[model samples]
Target: MTNDEKVRSIRSKIKCMKSTNEQGFDVIIWMRKRFLQSEAFVKNLKRIIDAGFIEKWTNYLNLQDISQRLLAREGAIKDPEIKFEEIKTIFVLLLVGHALAASVLILELWYSKRSRKY
Candidate 1:
């Protein structure tokens, strides 16, 4: 289990991936498929986050302000620095990122619209 899971488990154990309908303590995953601790086994689970996902982690880890600290932090597997020479590689990365964003936005819009349709 990961640190987040350990935190949750400390808070009376949520048995993993079981979500609740509470606020502040909820992880609003929406269209985002993976989180830092998300494992490969959790494939088709939609909006996967437990009731104790946030508070449990925050308190257990003493993060206090994890959101502000980790605001847009990212790293590369091998090449940490960006090379200006690989224009095609950069373009491909941009394209993939944009496509993923567009897909998420479209999914959100469609889901919202569908909810309204009911």
Candidate 2:
């Protein structure tokens, strides 16, 4: 469907949902959870997001913000190898930290044993 058509569909969904009072929040929550593709739909989402703020639906607004951030970051890590390397680097750092801690404990135990013998 065209972007304009998607915008109309989204608006209609919101309108029907609005008739049920609190269901407006449900519509916003649904939109926040879905992967909206159309630019127009995204724009509509941004515009309607203010309704959540005005309604004081803090949790829903936060979810919308998180979803928006996820969408913004969706294309940032397009390379699987790059992400794998990042994970590998983090894992190596954690392993090094654990090895250092273990070595310190072993040295402390050996030192205490030597002192006791003296």
Q: Against the true structure, candidate 1 has what lDDT?
A: 0.49
Question: Model 1, range 1-118, lDDT digits (tens) per residue?
Answer: 6644544444342232222312233233332334544544232221233444544554544443444345535432243675678577888899999999999999999999989953
- Residue 20, model 1: lDDT of 33
What is candidate 2's lDDT per residue for 1-118, written digit by digit as tens? 6655655565554532232233543243333334555575557675775456434454566566667678778755343456676689899999999999999999999999989953
Off by over 4 Å in 2: 1-21, 24-82
Candidate 1 shows a clash count of 0
Model 1 ranges off by over 4 Å: 1-85
C-alpha lDDT of residue 83 in model 2: 66
